[model samples]
Target: MTRTYRTLDVPVRGGDLRVGVWEDGTPGAPTVVAVHGVTASHLAWQLVAEALPGVRIVAPDLRGRGRSNELSGPAGMAAHADDLAAVFAHLDIPAGLVVGHSMGAFVSLAFAHRHPGLLARLLLVDGGLPLATPPGLSGDELVAAILGPTAERLSMRFPDVAAYLALWRAHPAFAADWTPELEEYLAYDLVPDGGGSLRPATSYRTTLEDTVDLNTGTAVTDALAALGHPTRFLTVPRGLQNEAPGLYSPEHAARLVATYPAVRHERWDDLNHYTVVMSEPGARGVAAVIREELSALG
Candidate 1:
């Protein structure tokens, strides 16, 4: 069965935050809130939604990205977490599971910390844990080292959505994973730049702020130190460009799991960071994990 997809503007701090809702049309079905990675929109979870026909997925265009790009104020993990609280309040979601990918995973950590009662369990995909970065690096250096081309693309201007799609189609990570769904996800990232060209909807400054907050700010560190919820983390063997070791090196992933002994951890050897939730195979794996968690909840 084809699940239904829709979007709505949920009122938040600066402006309305655009949220995507994917549902199976089964009344009272289990709902799961999904959070996209940095520089990505709610559409990143579309594949996962399709894979789980029995589930309802709620994802938001975080402030400073996607339709929420117009939202005012500085971006931080705490601010994003609070905005998530607003999302739950507006939707009247008392509590349920949350799946966060990349920066979304970091936001989920802060969200679980700030609004503990709102998250029953957390499924962190390739994020939420402290990244092992070199010391003595400036904020710009940190963003560059960690994000590389992902951050660079935010400053680029394209003549149209096609140009943007072309850029993504050329990405090494999507070389063998390209699909119409991936095309739609990339196309949604473009917005008019006011100069007749189109640019990615993610704001560079917002990305920087968020990058710094997640990597350097004490909120995530503190959250990690005080984690009390049932959490599961999934790491990919490859990264944004399909490079090996991905976000967390095997040793790093193992160390994190050891550090947070209570948090369940797994490494998906075949998928890259982006594909873990964006591609069909990756979505099937994630949907399976979500189903396991939901069944456990019951």
Candidate 2:
């Protein structure tokens, strides 16, 4: 069954936050709130939504990303978390499961910690745990190290959406698994810059600030120690570039699991970080886990 996809702009601190809602349209179905990665928008989760026809999914383009790119400063995990809390209040969803990918996981973590009454369950897809920061690295250095060349693309100019798609089509991580759904996800990232060029909807300053916050900020670190609800962490063996050992290296992963014994951990060696929720096999895996969590809730 083809589900219904709707777009809405929920009010936030400085401006309205864009949200994509995918639902089976069945009243009273289990609803899950999803959060996208740092540089990604809500469209990134469409594949996972398609795999769960009986579920209702809501995803937001965080402040300074996607349609919310127009939003001003005050971007960080705390601000983003508060904005998510507001999103829930605006939608009247007092409590629901939240699944976050990459940076979104941190935002979800902060949200759950600050507004525990709003989140019933939490699932972190390849993120949420405090990253093991290498010593002697500055914030910019850390961002460059973690994001690699993927971060460089944020400053590039594309002639148009087609050109951007071509760039992604050539990417080793996405070329083999590109789909119309993925195309939409990528295309939505483009916003027109003057002179007939385009750039990603995510702002560089926002990305930089967020990188600093997640890696060095207090919200996530403070929340990690106080996570009282049942939480799950899902990780991939490869990263944004399809590089091995992925985000949260083996040592870091093990340390996090040991430190937070209450949080469950699952690892997928075959799936890269991006494909873990953006491809057919990946979406199926993510949706299945979501279904399992939902069942467990009942």
Name the candidate that leads on TM-score.
1
lDDT of 2 by residue, 1-298 (tens): 5689999999888989999999876767888999999999999899999999889999999999899899876899999999998889888875868999999999999998999999789999999998777877787798898888778899999998899999998887885788899999999999998778999988777889999999987999889888877899998888989888889788889998999999999988778878998999999999999999998888
Q: After aligning candidate 1 to the native by TM-score, how far in Å is the CA of 4 from where it should be?
A: 1.0
Model 1: per-residue lDDT, tens digit, 1-298? Answer: 5678999999988888999999878877898999999999999999999988878899999999999999988789999999999999998885879999999999999999999999788999999998989988888899998899999999999998888888888899988899999989888999999999999999889989999999889989898888988999999999888999889999999999889998999988889999999899999999999999888778
Sliding window of 10 residues with minimal summed lDDT for model 1: 22-31
Q: Score every model by TM-score.
A: 0.98, 0.97
Q: Candidate 1 has what TM-score?
A: 0.98
* Whole-model lDDT values for every prediction: 0.92, 0.90
lDDT of 1: 0.92
RMSD for each model, in Å, please? 0.9, 1.1
